[model samples]
Target: MASLPPSDEATLTHVQSVLQTRTLSSPIYAFILTPLRITHASRGLIIARLVLAAPHLNASGSLHGGVSATLVDWAGGCAISTWDLRTGTGVSVDINISYLGGAKLGEEIEIEGRADKVGGSLAFTSVGIWKVEDGGRGSAVAVGRHTKFVRGSASKKVEDAVKTAE
Candidate 1:
């Protein structure tokens, strides 16, 4: 397995711990997708880093399209979470991704997400997946945009109704 650098060890450990617990609540994220470290986080922006692994590869041995899409979606959520918007409760209304290149296994990649706009009922976010280079000026592998609808009282009522029905 590819290992993080000494400087990133602590971050890796924390990411593992969070994934382990999140696995109980969100199995797909922990088991199927590779774990990632949040390198930077602030209001409206979040940056994540990961080393591509076997599970993230396609038949051609490059990063899979689906995996890239998932990362973009997750990154957007992370960006929104940085701002603590909508209590971090929102549903993706639409997501579009454009794949430009691919990263090989064991290669490190950076995912940067930015919340472009956050409205009362809607939020718009963009994400860029980059293949990290020597100078850390990585080339873009993919770019994506996501639109989310902030959960409101109507969403709560729907959840309540579902629970009552169940």
Candidate 2:
């Protein structure tokens, strides 16, 4: 029920509308075949929803490890963006994921990302993917840790200065 910045809200609305209209032609998201919806957004926390489907499953009919990894990566980045840190340019420097359990197709999963620490030039984040039960509680399926190198504030300042001089 939290809110995001105006700019981020616009971005979120666009992404949601794209998925809702089934007009998302991006290869990666299309291949996953899951509609990701932002449920919560704040300074250091973000929550999203993903309903698994055939394409997200493996031969054994559970969620694929690679797909989980990708979710972690994407969710972590989304969470970090909520902070609006340093002109909002951050790139993943390192990521680690652990598969804890299996999520069957048709299950609704909750993906949460938290910013553990945000420094001037680097940021640390953690992500968890969980299977949501009837009561809305979730069981952990995967957990991830991520590190990002942020580079935008200084560059933006320089660019602004140059533009002003012109």
Candidate 3:
């Protein structure tokens, strides 16, 4: 994962609040409060309910594949962290992305991700991306799955507690 800047870490609380309003923040039982904002957050979750901004645009005017990939990775990472086995910290072991279509500049693309399973030292997550206007149109622009190794920063048992509490 790319090291997030300070701005990203500072926005975590706000992002968590936003995720709370929409059912988008929680991927299963893991809370995705923020990506960059959470800094060293154990886990995070978010929804792509709208199109990206101009800064994230490509020359073709459509969203760039890099941007899409980054989005998937970010969401996928959050899913893994939320259900992290040992600590909130985890590292990606694998991420495979398949692109099928293009997204218009202003199209609201909805992306969702969650852990398929969290193991003793690894977590598996999958993210689905598609246009939101018609629910699901054309083919999927991209689909990605991330495998990560869990750390002991926060204790794997905490994840279990959170799950049980939910």
Candidate 4:
């Protein structure tokens, strides 16, 4: 497992607290994805864990495709936010996903988001949804790449988190 340096972790924590208080925050996350716990965060990465439940199932009782895509979108933004503590990560330009497996109710799965590149006008991110089997071996449930247009999205208040952490 990768870990963030203390300063970066402090920044992440500060940003997360601000995000949680906003009434206009992620509706999908507030509705169905609450209790989602971030296990680790680094400069360009985020790792989280959640248990599959009634709200996250498909007709066949496996993790829903839409849910998987939502995770990709949400996690991708989170990874981007870690890049420079941007509060508004950006708007999605494209999202591509490959379904590799399925997870059932009561199962715990991990979602990992990585910011491949963050540039002046665009940001690229990849996310992997993994289900762990016995002995702690993880297999991919889905993988996705996300591209977002991020020009002029940085906010001074959010950037202050980094300065305060430092």
lDDT of each: 0.70, 0.69, 0.56, 0.79
lDDT of 2: 0.69
Question: Which digits, one per residue and each the tens of the lDDT, describe model 2 over residues 102-139?
Answer: 99989988888777877778888999888999847478
Clashing pairs in 4: none
RMSD of each: 7.8, 5.9, 11.0, 3.6
Candidate 1's error at 70, in angstroms?
0.6
Q: Best candidate per lDDT, number? A: 4
Best by TM-score: 4
Q: Which segments of model 2 are wrong by more than 4 Å?
A: 1-26, 85-89, 153-166
Ranking by TM-score: 4, 1, 2, 3
Enumerate clash totals for all models, in the order shown: 0, 0, 11, 0
Which residue pairs collide in model 1, if any? none
**TM-score of every prediction relative to native:** 0.75, 0.74, 0.60, 0.85
- Model 4: how far is 160 from its true place, Å? 4.7
TM-score of 3: 0.60
- Predicted structure 4, TM vs. truth: 0.85
Residues 84-137, candidate 4: write the lDDT tens digits: 777777789999999999999999889888899999889999999999677353
